[model samples]
Target: MSPQPQAAVGAPLSRVDGRLKVTGKALYAAEHDVKGALHAVIVDASVGRGRIASIDTRAALAQPGVLKVIHHGNAPKLPYRDNPASNNPPDGRRLRVFQDDQVLFHGQPVAVVVATTLEAAQHGASLVKVEYDERKPSTDLEKAKADKPTTYARGNAEAGLRNAPVRMDLTYRTARNHHNAMELHATIARWDGNKLTVWDKTQWVVGTQTELSTVFGVPMDSVRVISPFVGGGFGSGLRCWPHVVVAALVARELKRPVKLVLNRRQQYFGTGFRPAYEYRLRLGSDRRGRLAAMVQELDAETSSYEKFTENVMYAGQMMYSMPNVSQAYRTVPLDVNTPIYMRGPGFATASYVIESAMDELAAKLGIDPIELRRRNEPSEDESTNLPFSTRRLRECYTTGAREFGWNQRRAKPRSRREGDWLIGMGMAAGVYDTARMPAQAHVRLDADGTAVVDAAASDMGPGTYTSQTQVAADALGLTMRTVAFRLGDSLFPPTPPHGGSMTMASVGSAVLDGCNRVRQQAIKLAVEDRESPLYGAEARDVIVRGGRLHLNSEPARGETYQRLLTRNKRSHLEALGSFAGPAAKERHSFYAYNATFAEVAVDAALGLVRIRRVLGVYDAGRIISPKLADSQAIGGMVGGIGHALLEHTVTDHRDGRIVNANLADYLVPVNADVPDLKAIYLDGEDPNADPLGVKGLAELVMIGVAPAIANAVFNATGRRVRELPITAEALL
Candidate 1:
């Protein structure tokens, strides 16, 4: 670590770029003013499983302003070198568009029409006619069958379940969820000879660069993915989807830049989504509320061409101290588009069922819900057999119970009521594995004493730009105003995907690296230069404050950064900081924990559960920016509300097509749905986690939120609904 300036790291500061967002000056992927960029529209497959039988581009090619049509028969064959690093595509076979006529699933990209205008391309896509020799598609998870299952076993669960005094066997279902970011998925591709420049909505620029390089068979240096502003990506933008490739293909064929943007309807089917899951759990516990054994069977939706599996059973193996455990997670590859990661991924789905089961056991045994969970908290991650870097779940439970007034919750259902509403409170524990990835950042101190920090990161509505600015301000000897942070472009230092709650811990460490390097360089220059005030001072004894380097004992005797740079005839100083990852240690367990509480008002007659208030208290290491962290917590809690009450992607099931593919049909949480929400971050930092002592918070905020609310609804009505979107119909 390099020496840095003194500024508050945890103080609540306003977003640095809030003005740009409110004024609409921030350039999203489609908003980038690319001149003369031809518009392109993609035509998706109407059938779930089929193959094109004949060529029918005559009508589309004849449309006014329609430049050309690219399909499987006439499109270029891309060189897709298997780069497993950024290709988080869990399924081995990547989706290759326009290279073959074999249709893998419904809504697969079949053809792309390029035109002089967007409207022309849109109309041209509608004009394209196709006939397919269709086959009966297996879109139903229960009906579709596969080979042997992936299994995990510890001690004999059969023997343990036999010896247990009490047991429960139940099944839970969660519907598919779309990302539905405010800004739709868009791509603008421009090719200059062999070099390609693209404006894309991506979470990871370096990852996107790697994937595009593999797709185009070009060197990594030849491709540049620039996206300075992203509206939001729960996990939808993690991979390079097919539309990005179509835009690039159209640009290369026409010898002109091409821009393709998916509308709200296209967004539902075009981008990836959270796979619907069917989980069956058989849990055995003693009369004392101690877990004895567990057996879990997990099945999720995937595409026919690939295998997509979520860590849906990860939390079950490690959360509680169970002696015997057996788990099997498998994917039912259906004739539907492949599912990508959502906000919480596997854990969110798993948490809902596991927590619900725990609540059930508490009810059966006539014990308090919190007391039941308190008896099962484990000391370490039993599955990995490795100590966590820092686990604070106990503190979360202790503090959250007091703050949310959990002690007042009634142990029996329908114990409280308000008019026609059955009022109740519920709380649940949350956990997320703090993922870390390698990232880099560049820092420079100009002669004017203002520092510039550049990294290939993004805000994504979580305030990455603002939080990183705070980190830089503290790392360098400057106020928030003197330090400027820039991100969302590949030209800056490379970074990983912005999801997974790892951005803060990974990217903040990188910014700390660069700022510390810059600060050290200034200190060395000032100490060695005879004209400096602290020329003879030891480097260790000198510290920076408010952009000035001074001695520890004598604060008044200092050298301004501008003075040192001007006298040395030095224009500026630069440094690059990076974090490779921490060495694995054995002493302490490491996991960020949260305690979420929800209050619901269920109408006894109508069976409609309306959330009135919600609160989340998190024990994530150190908070770099309080405001940004609060925003993350609130956003996550709001997403949780959506998970519990709304946000369901309904599939027609008749023809294996998503029936509600638009925002109007598919529901998300509206302003009226979310009323009072609160996020609280515990004041603490773990030295072992990273140089910045900050664990990521994006994913942690949304974990177990749905389960918490569902449990609360049960406390209100004594109705245990296993399926998600616990809609009015289910309650009724």
Candidate 2:
């Protein structure tokens, strides 16, 4: 039998929601209208570490339209129940709003003022004075004491390092980064009787709902969260923050809807950011560049209250073939909020350290950077001894090298110069785990030949709405316009949090399952009906296209879904699509791989650097939406540029104040910073990864970007600086 032709799955379709966004019809969290909703502004702590000494609310009460001022002194005690299912980290207690007078970090919410208008709330909040006994804060990562190390070991690293022919020890530092999504963290909470409804800007509505319910000592079902649109969320919205609690608590107390929005400065304190890191790496390799052993020491900043941790050491365990490997990852509790996942999370940080060291090793060995990686590539996951589902990193390197004109690059440093600008090319390998969580989607086929797919997922500027719609359209044999994908609602079918680049592999698979089931049901009915043209045909032999069921061999003989359903007296068909996840214990290692190449030009005398070109080739299983994938790849490259040369969150260690809290001071890549950027996705699918054959793409796009740019800098000049945001001083 001939295979069915694909028209939507691999097509380069534009975003389905682009028009709504450009036309200003899309509504965000703060845009939701609630009758008589009060405005709220929170008063932040003046000190990073301190105890509240006194509070004054007399002047705040005199503000026009000021209704109430909430603080630890006057606010009611919340349940603050311990919830194991909440998004809180595994260790330490979650922050309880208005439950204590101790300030653990700078920018902690000390009080809130509620008023009829935003201006009144701002004035009242300013008038609510707070006095605290300030204490010196441990905000600097280098000086802070680290907790007991979490260690991992395999073979004898000490012996391997002593016996190796070549050895290198290097240290790298990465600055703290924040997820500055265009939309502020805002929430509008309204209560009626025992139920609460909230319109919030979050990546995980279910997680927020659960946290809010537990905080208020209410049933989980009593709280409903609606967020039809989000400006952007990298990973900041993965967990519920204290401000969300404040909004709900204030709304419940006032018996009126309360709207709370964090301004640009408050966002730094309100949510999480990518913690600054200091990574020390030591490598022992043979004469041919095969790694003999490695030892890694990692330290990262975390909130003093919560011991937040990410998968920082996972890449060291399996990225290359090494018999002797040892690692110690320690979290340094400091006067700061807990760090959360940014674009690539821990892997991006690790890749910069490891891959940059790889380039250094290549320079010492006088071998091509790509050649050095090939010499150490492992056939299977060395850590787990499991075969890979799909390991196409070799293809990525070769294809990327060819397309990027790597052959023209000079192996020697400072060899290519045009006037005062020195041009050099560098490449690095990247990999991210193929993670899939259990997810479900509810699909409905209406009588009018249209379909609706619902899931409690989020877009977060990754094109989830458009990509899911394409998946459903292809599965249900309908046009893109005929299928509607609904997400970001608690009432929809439950899905995993919309980060980790797993939405496509997880939620997409669920949509496919549900839509396929509905199509199969229709096929069964038509084959069994006597009047149908598809009658007596085997179910497997029939295929659907454009809502018409036809024999695979005879495309002209078929009936529209509406005609067949009308004859059968059916209004709609519904089905639940679900993916239960990999088996309890997986037999294979699954991951997406990429090879990133960067060409950079540096001004030798003035210490100025500029990117000339960047190309990323990825082995990310399937391309559900080619156009969207391109956008994701380019965006990742832009973020990488920021991480390498622009973005930094400055802190005043004496008082634990964020020095650069606003966008102007905390730099990001503007349009002028990005140059010629390109991406190429290797065409293929992993059957073991997911039903959709996708291993994940969003995070993979950014995994090795920083290291690639850094290596290019080294090739341009003879300098090997190990710090992030390669500044002019470092180059000089």
Candidate 3:
């Protein structure tokens, strides 16, 4: 088959759903209007860890519009079957909502009040009272006992450290962070006989469907999940939370639709968060900055019910060249909700520590930070001993340094000042492994010269709808307006989770294949039909442009798809395309690389740090949409600023309660906090990574942001605060 014209693939296009979003036409999970849907509010336990001793619901049940109060004593016992296919942790049992009196964490859902109106539900919930046998909670990461460690070793790390000329040991701490998206976590569930349907805020519809089916002990086909639009989900919606099941359970019990929207205060515990981490790194290097050995010990927070983990050790082994390396990762179970992936996840946390340590090492050796990193560049991935499919860190460094005026930076800290403020600039390199999974997409081309492509993919915020449309438009030889892309429906062709920076590589490739197949089917009909204009033309020499099939060499010798399909008396042509993911025996290690730079001004008297500018240069394969890519880059930088200087989920260890749960108390970067931000993409594609040649940009943009800012703070004030959220008190 001939290649389609490259018109829309790399074009800068606006989001297809932008107008709907701005006009409030895009319906989020809580906004869905289901007929006869009752409201439910969960009653939380006051103590962190304890068992419910007694409950009083007489006053709540007497309220007007109150329907029922369901607790462990009154709620029927659910099957609570094990579901390995979902995102639940594998180590321990999941929390069964309202199943027993045991309270595993503070704010555990002990009971729920159902009423015809949301206000009634809230009032009834507030009226109800519950007493608990309170117990002290193990909420402190430092004090809690850790589970067995997951260990990795490549060489004799301790011996290498002992023999190296220079050595350093550093410990860094990062606070927990909540997603805090604009829209709250919500679910609207309705049961029709044995079948269940839910409109949820989720990143993966099929995952939710499978989890709900398994939880209810029903067939997979008996559950349906629909999520057409999401306000934002920084990995919080990656799994089916307990509230989703609670909504479904209540709806089934009452034989009516149930709507549950977690209030802002409840959202803190209702959804997953980015776990707090304590990382200890030991490093040994030669005088010239060549790495010799490294050892890492990490402890992260997780719930007592289940153990959660992330890819925290990958960077320590492969980011730089090291002969000897060892790692031990442990999860400390606490009286908290399970943690999930957030933006960059493990890579973000690792990059902050590694990059900061590199800066410290450079300062110690009197060598330039960029030059020190160049000296440690690896020839291949030492972890797997495989050649890199595309490692462009050198190019990223050169590009970012030149673009951000790196040469003007002073090597001495606190040397450059502007009246009451000190200025500094810092840069860090980041890498994230490219991930792709099996996916399928369905495409249909009608006689009207239009195409529709769909998959069970989602767009939390990264413009998946527009980018997929671009892929389909070019492949099907249709205009952007003529190619319609739909998603977030379990009925569509299955796709992998929207996180992990894999949607474009996996789902877009499937859409491309499906569209290509449909376009080929149309061309075959035109070439073989005796009544067609290009009946004798070779199929290989034929090309499609704007719904017209023509010879590649002659533009005038073709007919529109409408003409060909109308003459053939065919309504439409459809195809299901799939990408089988990466090969079993991978030939190369694939990862996206970036160099992030930041400029900051610090006020010593006031102890305030202001971000002046941020620049990110990426070698993330081919960019499908430049405008949307910029949006992602800028948003990531803003988030990085928050992680470095402001965002922190403060918990009171006395009761395992989050004191700053509301947005009013929690600080995030607003319009005033964001500075001049820019993103530059290296021009090229990695054919080895995936069919689309995209190594995933969304997560890569966020990996090095926090580290860059943190390093800049040290350069400005000569103060190395090992902890995150570099507050004014720390500087003082």
Candidate 4:
């Protein structure tokens, strides 16, 4: 069959839901108006690790409009059924809400106050008092003991290190980070007899449904989850948090709908955040700057109750080629909330250590940073011994370097200065696994010439609605406006969680399949009918454009969908699309690659760093939406700027309390911090990755950004600050 014309896929289209959003007509989770819904506020414990000694709720019960005050002392015993298949962390039991007097972390919910109004709920919550037997919590990551180390090794790293000509050992620390999405973590849950309905701000509706069903000991069919809009996730909403269960449990007890919204401060403890990491890296390289061995020791923070682990060792095993590699990754259990996947998750953290180490090695060997990376580039994925599905990193580097004016950068540190500012450029190579999971989508084409495609996916500011609509419109041979995409509902066709940059690769493939089948059904009907203009034409030879089925050989031989369906008395055409994920034994190692460049100016006297410019060249399979891809890339770089110089979540080791839990205390990059930024996608597709030909872009864009900025800082001021959020004190 002839390839579909490139009309919508690569086009820079505006978001279809922009108008609805700007007009404030789009409903988010907490915005849903549930009549007679009561408000619930949780009372947090003062101590981190302790046992509740006494609870006094008499004063709260006396408050007007207060419906009920429930605590562990009086709350009913929940089923708390185990659900390993859910997004819960592995090996450890999830925190059972209001099931015991034990306090695992500071700000743990000790009790809940339900009131007829939000104001009353707040007043009641403040009136309730709780006393605890406090214990000194081990919130400090450095002091906590790490669990059994997970090890990975290739050749003998010790022998390789001993034989190498040059070596360097470095230790780096990254601070904890919060998601801090625009919208609060909110849920409105209502129970009708045995059935439960919830409107939540979440990334995965089906996952939430399954979690809630399992938690309440109810069948999955009895739970319905809806989330039409999300302000932003960045990975915070990936799991169903404890507050969601609290809302549902309270609603079931009161026999009325309950609305619970965490304030900005409560969000810090209510939702998951990126864990702090301590990484020690040792690199052995030849005189030519070729990596001979790499030994990585990693320790990350996690909650005492759950074992939360990410792929932090992945980049060490595969990012750059090395004859010998060894890794040990351990999670240090602390009196804190369980960590969850943040933006780039493991790849972003590991890339910072590896990429920065590579830059250091380049300086030690007196070679250009880009040249050093090029020297160690492997022909295939050495870790898996499989050829890459699409490895255009060389092209990305060349393009990014050229476009970023790499030739202007001097090899020496602090070579260029403007007044008190020293300018420098740095670059890094990034890789993220191209992951695709089984997904299903449903596409329906009505006789009115409009279509709707449904999938249980999420947008989360990545333009899933616009991109999926583009895919469906092109596949069904319709204009972009004629097709509508719907998501974030459990009733829609099931899809993988809208994270890990896999939505386009997985859900989009299913959308393409379904739309094609529906369009093919129409062509089949037209070609088989004797009265149709496309009669007797081969199905492959027939193409649909603007809802008209026409012979490819003869453009004039065609009929509109309205004419054909109206004449045949067919109401609509529908089909279910699906994509089977990777096979048991994969033929290729699929990964998205990026070459990220950054220019920074640092004030030596003041220890202030300013970003001059950033450029990211991506070899991310295919460009689904260029405009949206640009937004994603720019946002990723801005986030990296925050991670490099602005953002940090501070925890007080004395009592295990988050010192800076609000936005005013914790900082992120603002418009002033970001200057000129550009994103370039190498024009290409990887048929081996998925049907949509898109490698994940969201996570890939963020992976190498921090390292690039950090490397630039080193070049600018001749300061190699190993810790993230390189404050002025470290630079000075």
Candidate 5:
């Protein structure tokens, strides 16, 4: 069902909304118009942790256009109900913003100032002074002690290490990183007769609606969220943060629609970020290169108010076939704001240590890195004891090695070089367990032979709108131009959060179901109409192609869907499709695999590190759109380059404040930094996983990228940098 030149699916076509985005006509959250709308700015707490003594708003109220400043003192004590719909907020109790004076962390929202204009709101917020009783904050993870270590042991690590010949005890440190999606987080809220409507930049509209309902003590139905276009999310937009709630609260207090856009500086404090992680790996292997045992100690940061868990212990448990393995994963609650899921999350942190440590062992044993991994490949997921739904990691490595010319890599460190630049190639394997969630979509078939698919699913730069349109076109037997896909409105069908690379699998499945139903209904109508060709043919034998339905055996004897609809006196047909999750997922394991190869240059004396090229081979299973899949791949590689050589979120431990909150100070990979990057998805699909037979590609592209770069650095300079960013200072 590929359209020529514009082959709807698997074609390298650009975004359908590229024109609107480039022309600046795409309205983001703050860009939406609200009648008689006021602007709101948040006032942040000055102390790390303590109680708010007083909030003075006299000067702010005296300012021109300043309507009101809402703080805990004057704010209403609303009912914060328990909502288990979201798998968040353990024990069903959550943070009640503006309902109490307890300041949990620095930069906590203390008050919100509303005014006629954005500038007036900013000026008013600057005038609102907040005094707090400060307390000593614990921002250091090393100094903190854990109450208990979640231990897992399959065999005695001590015994294995004693009997085995080779072992390496290495530790890695990954700095905190912010998602830094180009568009700042913003929300526009309006309340009319106890009903709330918001245009918010969110990854999950249903989650936001539920959270807002809980906070405002309103019914979920009374709230509707809209987010049509998003610049980028990575993972920052996955959760509904407190700032969104503040926008609604301010709008309700002012009794006028209010738009609250987080300033550039506010993005650092306003949104969630990937927490810093410290991982220590002890790998024990035989002299022949077979893994004997693995032990990992992982510590990550979280907020004091809530328990945030990232499955850091996942990779060590299932990546290899080691019988003896033990992992102690602990979360150190810090005084900083709560952290949210980021790209690769726990797996990214663990891979840095595990992969780097494996490279070190390869160096010590004088074995090829690829050969070593192949020697230890697991037949099944060790942790779950279930067969993989689709595990082509081995194939990924084989194809990647051939395509990347991995065999050309030399064994001896510093063996490959040209003049002063030391060029070395390295590769690492990465894993991510594929996930599925329930989703719903509504598809409409028009009498004019055009179709429209509507869902609350968002296209946060991953081409959800375009990709889903392709799926609908193939399923509905229609041309790409005739089908229009619309998203980002709560009035549409419900959808899950767009993070974790699950949108394609989740939403695509829903689209398939909806379109299948619509097509079946059309087929039924055509057979009964007597106007359609081969009218008496069974519905099962009826096949549609190029917007026409007819018998598969006799293509010439067919009629256009438009003709059938018009002759049947039907104006349009609509179908609602919902893909419920599998009840027995344990029957088979599902995971996405990738093999990343990197070429790096390291200066012998200056220790300057530069990535020469990167190629990622993915076993994500049945790429829905090759063009869009490649886009996801390239975007991920760029993010990986940042994680390897640039991106770092620096915090001032003294005050528990982020130091370099702006992009100018905190660096990311630019065009000049990433020279040559490419991605290739293996041509295959697994029906056992889902109806779409598509595993996610977004996160897998970034999984082993840092390790590949790190391994390349080691090969070039003979220095194994377990810590991330493999920066010039670390090399020097």
Candidate 6:
């Protein structure tokens, strides 16, 4: 069939839901007005570990407006049937809310008070008393024992290292980080007899539905999750947290709607965080800066109950060409909550260590960093021995160096200075695997030349709503204003979780398929109809544009969809589209690549670092929306700045409690902290990646940011801190 006119797909369109959001019409999870809903406040455990000895709820129950106070002593035992489909850890049982007196971690929810108003719930929760058999907690990564290591070895790394002339061993540490999205993690649950519905802040409504069903031992269809709008979610909302279950359980037991919203302090322990990591690297390279061997040993923090892991070792194996490589990744189980993916996740942390090490190697060999990296560029992914589908990292480096004025940088550290400030420029390369999963979308084109597409996806502050609309608009041959895209309802077509940077490639492909099918149905109807214009024309020769079907060779001979559908007495045409992801045995390695450059000014006397500028050149495949892509890039750079210099979740290891839980103590990059920032995308497409040709930009943009800044700090100050949040004390 002839292709539809490509008008809206690449256009720089604003968010379709922008006006609704700015005008206060868009309802977030907590904003949904459920009638007669009670408020619930969770009471946290004071101790870090050990079982609860006694609980007293007399004061809470006596409080005015307090409907019920539920705790382990009085709460019913839930079925919590196995649900392998959800995002829970595969090897361990999930924490069941209010199931037992066991205290797994500091700030564990001991009880919840439900009342008519939020104020009453808060007051009642404060009045509740609890005593615990406290035990010393093990929260420090250095002090805790690690689980069995997940080992990988390709060649004789020790022998290769022994034969090489140049050898270096280094250790790097990254502090824990919180998601800290503007919207609090919240849920409002309502039950009608056996059926349950919840308005939640989540990245995957279907995942939440499945989890709720399994927890209550009910049919999946009986639980419906609705989340129309989300302020932000940097992977924290990917799974159903314990607080969501608490809300649902309260609603069901009390036979009334219940709402629970975690406050800022509770957010630190209530949800997941980016775990701290200690990575030690031993490398052997020739005098010419070509790597010969590498050995990587990493220890990361996780909860004692569930083991959490990320792609921390991929960079060591595939980022460069090495004949011998060995890796051992061990998780140090501590008295803390399980960790989740935050922004770039494991790749970001790995890039910092790998990129910083590359800079150090370049300094040792008197070689340019970019030239050294070029010399070690791999012809294929050595881990899988698969040719890359589209590896434009070289192009990204060239373009970024040219754009960021890399030639102006001085090779010597602390050589360029402006009075009390030291100036330096640095760059780092980044990569993220192109991830895709099976997804489905539903489409309906009405007789009025308008179309509506539905998918069980989410827009977690990345403009998913607008980008998907663009795909649908162009594929259906309709104007952007005429196409309506709806998501975040479990009743819609199933879609994969809205994280992993796969939403556009997976969900957008499904939407394109649905719209294309609907358009073809209209074309077939118009051509076969005896009373229509150009009735005998071949359907293959017809193309749609502006809601009108016409012969590709003779555009003037056409009929509007409105007239054709009105005459046929049809209300609308519908179709369901799907994407079956990649093949079982993938033949090619696919990944998005980027080169991030940073310029910084460090106060020589005060030891303060100020970012002068940042530039990111990405080789992520086809960009569906340029404006949205810029937004993602800028947000990522800001987040990276925080990761490098400001953000750190400080834990009081004595009690396993996060001391800097609130925004006042935990710092982030603000407008004043961020200077000039820019993003450039290479114009290309990878057919093997996905139907949309997008290799996923959100995560790639963030991967190299922290390392770039860290390298710049080293060049400016000639000091290697080897830890995140390069503080003034470390520099001084």
Candidate 6 matches the true fold with a TM-score of: 0.99
Worst 10 residues of 4 by lDDT: 82-91
State each model's CA lDDT, in order.
0.86, 0.92, 0.93, 0.91, 0.85, 0.93
What lDDT tens digits, residue by residue, belong to model 4 across residues 1-732? Answer: 755655898899999999999999989999999998999999988898999999999999999999899899988998888876575455698898999999999988999999999999999999998888889999999988999999999999989999999989999999999988899999999999999999999998888998998899999889999999999999999999999999999999999999999999988888889899999999999999989999999999999999999878878888788989999999999999888999999999999999999999999999999999999998888889999888988899899988999999988998889999999898998989888888999999999888999998887899999999999988988999999999989999898888899899999999999999998999899999999998888889988788778887788999998899888999999999999987879999988999999999999799999999999999998899999999999999999889888899998888988989999999998899998999999998999888878889999898899999999988988889999988988988
Error of 5 at 57 (Å): 1.5
- Candidate 2 error regions (>4 Å): 1-4
Candidate 4 residue pairs that clash: none
Off by over 4 Å in 5: 1-7, 88-93
TM-scores of all predicted structures: 0.98, 0.99, 0.99, 0.99, 0.97, 0.99
- Encode model 1's per-residue lDDT on 1-732: one tens digit a residue: 224444668888888898988999989999988889999999998887878886688898898999999999898889988877764667558788888888877788899999999999999999999889888678887888853578988899988998899999999998889999888899999999999999999988878888889998999999999988889989888878889988988899999999999878778768889988889999899999899999999888888777877667778888888989999888887888778888888888888888889989999999888889989987768887877777777788788888888888988998999899998888887877777778899998999999899999876788888888888888786889998899878889988888888888889899998888888889899888888888887888888888888987788888888988988988999999998865554355556788888889999999988998888888889988888888888888888888888888876666667788888888888888886888888888878878888777888889878999999999999899999989988888
Candidate 2 CA-lDDT value: 0.92
**Between candidates 4 and 6, which one is better according to lDDT?**
6
Q: Using alpha carbons, what is the TM-score of model 5? A: 0.97
Please report the TM-score between candidate 2 and the true structure.
0.99
Candidate 6 Cα errors over 4 Å, as ranges? 88-90
- Please provide, for model 5 over 250-348, each residue's C-alpha lDDT reduced to its tens digit, 9 standing for 90 to 100: 888778899989988788878888888888888899997899988788888777776677767888999988888888887887787878888887888
TM-score of 4: 0.99
Candidate 4 regions off by >4 Å? none
